[model samples]
Target: MLADPMVLILMYFVLPVWLIAGFADWLCHRATHIESTTGAKESLIHLLMFVEVGIPLLAAMFLEVNALVIAVMIVAFFVHEATAMWDVRYATTARTVGPIEQHIHSFLEMIPLMGLVSVVSLHWGQFLALFGTGTERARFDLAWKQEQLPVTYVAIVMLVIALFELLPYVEEFFRGLRANAGRLVPAKARRREAGDTAIR
Candidate 1:
């Protein structure tokens, strides 16, 4: 039920914190001049990570939180983590991933896990069903939430996501693309350029 404390925390607290962290991460990227350093490749990786996490998040918001949904959330979290590591590895090859960005990254990485824990706690029965330890059979079929979140609230959240998270990243990608233009230099090449420029 939406009134449940765990659900409330996941919906209001966890979700907002995640969004804020996401926007903050974008700010960090801009501050570090991601367009000039990491370029569009890194921006693409960012969009990939967003979708990896977004699919399960949308499902959780719109669908029933059953064994199948819980399973999806768990899987998505792991996939997102892997992608995050890839993102950082590639990024650090080209730019300085400073402490502020690293701190923002910590929140981005862990908030999904925290939200998953909250969801599992709220649907303990369904989570147990996934492990075959519950009284009810595990539900793998997707179904709409019986008690839906308010339409206005969902709309507002979606608007915030598009405005704050999605659009800004999209713009970042284009900025990188425009800056790179015809340049297809590798990360190592770019780093070498920076080093050579420093030497001169």
Candidate 2:
């Protein structure tokens, strides 16, 4: 198990911890946005990123764990979170949306997706054991044991990017049909969003 250092770091150090940071951040990020439905509240997603960011790295450092493992997770989680924030910034409104509009509202919909992704990974212990951490190094040699399970991979992959990528394509396709599911934004709302609508 403690054979290849890279696998060791990946399986134990980075994979699990990164999951923690990214998933937790994702959840908190979604909750904030869903609760308010306006303003930069959703932008606070980065805050969750920070909390779990250093935890794995720091723990790895003190416990003689793998720094490389920590580094990889930090990077992956950051990319995922950063893109999400931009998606939210681009979509800043709380218009009433039907199923189609709701689908097109990528950032808003991610709230629940994020919750599922982040919350599902709260089982840190299982992640560690699966990575091969029970004997010696508890968190520095795990290598995506989950990947071995194709079905699990499917679920994991879907949970990760389903909302961001898949949902958009579906929405756009249906949108072209003027399906009864979507909405043409009111001219006034569009104007307001465009900074043309006058204030009361």
Candidate 3:
């Protein structure tokens, strides 16, 4: 399998894609505050993209290779790409994305396309073979093939991006909690403290 040219192509492109996606995500977070603009909605969309892409890619590494898996991956990939394109348009038109941010967005958009191309190239034969088989050929099973190290590495990078995307909402949750706590404090105690301060 390592001898396959498509496998080699995927191995080569995976790292660059992970690095570019991470950096572009950081740039986006830096360019806009989550609560102030469309950042929250955009981030949520990104989270979906991560789930769709990362999960299938990871599964493909360990699962039995089959036509059904390839079909699922193809569908997932297209959905991921669509969300990514929507993210770019949403970021650019719905909010004020800076020149640097726009550049980052454009580059980020290409990473998935390249990845899809590589994956499709790698599995093209299998996909075509599926069509030739009868309906009874459809089966999902784990082949327990040795894990692809690159898939794991990419998943880790995406996890970091997930954390970064989540941080803003986490902060907002705590801020709201604190605000509610303050409101619940005893008003009489606050007035007593104020009187003590005046007496000093």
Candidate 4:
């Protein structure tokens, strides 16, 4: 499995590209000052999309690539697509999504599909068995990879995800929340200011 070009693409190319794209997307959000405009609501949506893709990603990394895993990947890709649409629609309403961000969004959207295709290619027999047409039998049981990925590589990936993807987004959410909180003015304070103005 390790020597296969498809697996190589998945491990060396697809994974790194996806991580880079995710970090780039986060930078785009920061550049647009999403915290001030769309606020935490938009940040929340971003986190949701992260989880949608993250689940299948983790599955593929650790679990055996079987019918169940392929099915999860396919379903997740569609769900991510729907969430991406929602994110753009909501984001455009309140923030400026410039050309750079738009391009980054394109990467963010397509990388998962690319990864899914590679996975299906690597596990073609299982994928075909999914629809009952393949020579191989479909296995849906959840089991770890027979030969696990190198510990150092998995550690690096997890660190990158936490530092680049997860932490940055979580910080973005808090920034949005704090910005929104600061904008809130009490009705009583407003009325008091209004009365004072009348007296002047």
Top candidate by lDDT: 1
TM-score of 4: 0.89
Which of the two candidates, 1 or 4, achieves a greater TM-score against the reference?
Answer: 1
Of the two candidates 1 and 2, the one with more favorable TM-score, higher being better, is 1
| 1-200: candidate 4 lDDT, tens digit per residue | 77888888888888898889889988888887777666777788899999999999999999999999999999999999999988877676566677888888888889899999989988999999999987999999999999898899899999999999999999988888787774422222233322121111
Spell out the clash pairs found in candidate 1: none
TM-score of each: 0.91, 0.28, 0.62, 0.89
- In order, how many clashes per candidate? 0, 7, 1, 0
- What RMSD does each model have against the real structure? 3.1, 12.9, 11.7, 7.6
Candidate with better lDDT, 1 vs 3: 1
Off by over 4 Å in 4: 182-200
Error of 3 at 146 (Å): 4.8
lDDT of 1 at 158: 99
Q: Which ten residues in a row have the lowest lDDT in candidate 1?
A: 191-200
Q: How does each model score on lDDT? A: 0.86, 0.39, 0.56, 0.83
Ranking by lDDT: 1, 4, 3, 2
lDDT of 1 by residue, 63-116 (tens): 999999999999999999999988887777667788898998999999999999
> Which 10-residue span in candidate 2 carries the lowest summed lDDT?
191-200
Scanning candidate 3 in windows of ten residues, the lowest lDDT window is: 191-200
Q: Work out how many backbone clashes candidate 2 has.
A: 7
Better of 2 and 3 by lDDT: 3
Residue range 129-199, candidate 2, lDDT tens digits: 54676443444454443324245544664464445433433333343224222333323234335212132
